[model samples]
Target chain A: GEEVAQTPKHLVRGEGQKAKLYCAPIKGHSYVFWYQQVLKNEFKFLISFQNENVFDETGMPKERFSAKCLPNSPCSLEIQATKLEDSAVYFCASSQSTYGYTFGSGTRLTVV
Target chain B: LAKTTQPISMDSYEGQEVNITCSHNNIATNDYITWYQQFPSQGPRFIIQGYKTKVTNEVASLFIPADRKSSTLSLPRVSLSDTAVYYCLVGASTGGFKTIFGAGTRLFVKA
Candidate 1:
């Protein structure tokens, strides 16, 4: 596909419930990146994948945040136990070269 | 990754030309300057990118000096619909390197 595809436009989860988001990068793009945007600003990098392997996850919270990009499937970001502060818009982007990135409409996660 | 600095906010009238400048004093040789425009509830969209000199597209123009330490995004005759947050990113988006976004410039175009 020409544009990156993200599933579940909006999700509402309980404090302790698990929340999962999906992203399908553009075809032929080898890198997939996930970002968390809070309060309409402050974009925090969460994780990235080079194919099915984890590339850089330094920004990801070690305790409750985990992500995976498997073959023939859309990439997924999972939250073990959702917290109130976890409410934000989660964006996924795909890049092929040094040119630029193509971002998908993010998944809005609200934990009550 | 090279870090970029931009104005926190800017205001302009409709049908006015707006130029948003960004400074990346520590930019490296391989780093490229890219700009993204984001609306209130949408993801950031790639606007323009340049390595040096000037690059122009239908959307906007990107100008870079010889030093490559600073770049400007030129939006000609912007209207109210063009009002959005503009982000200046400095990095190599290739080789699995992530594109890090800095604090963007909030451009408010009013009638």
Candidate 2:
């Protein structure tokens, strides 16, 4: 497809529950990236994948956050035991070996 | 990764030329400057990118000096629709690298 597609436009979870978000990159793009936007600003890079392999994860929180980009499946970012601070919009972007990235509409995650 | 600095906010009337400048004093040799415009509740949209000198697109223009320490994004005759947060990023264009974003300039275009 032409655009990066994200599922579940919005998700609400209990503080101790789990939350999972999905992203399907553009058909030809080889890389996928996940970002968390807090306060409607401050985009925090979460992780990146180079064709189903983890590329960079330095920005991801160590304990409760995990992600995967598997072949023939959409990429997923999972948060375990979600906390209050976990309430934010999660964005997915796809790119090739170039400078620009095409982003999805994003999934709003709210932890109550 | 290169850090950038920009204004917190700026106000402009409609049909006015708006220029937002960014400073990346530590820009590396392989770095390219890129700009993105983000509206409320939407993802950032790529505007223009340049390594040096000038790059003009149908939407906006980018001007970079020889020093490569600073660059400006010029919007000709901006309308209310142009009001949004503009982000300046400097990084290696190797693609899919973890990008660093700073506090973007909030542009408020009024009528």
Task: State each model's CA lDDT, in order.
Answer: 0.92, 0.92
Backbone clashes in model 1: 0
Residue-by-residue lDDT tens digits, candidate 1, B1-111:
788899999999999899999999999899889999999878899999989999999989999999999999999999999989999999884766776788999999999
> Which sections of candidate 1 miss by over 4 Å?
none
Candidate 1 residues A13-95, lDDT tens each? 99999999999999999999999999748898898899999999988997999999999999999999999999999999998
Clashing pairs in 2: none
TM-score of chain A of 1: 0.98
RMSD value for candidate 2: 1.0
- All models, RMSD in angstroms: 1.2, 1.0
Docking class of 1: medium
Candidate 2 regions exceeding 4 Å error are none
Top TM-score prediction, candidate number = 2
Pairs of residues clashing in candidate 1: none
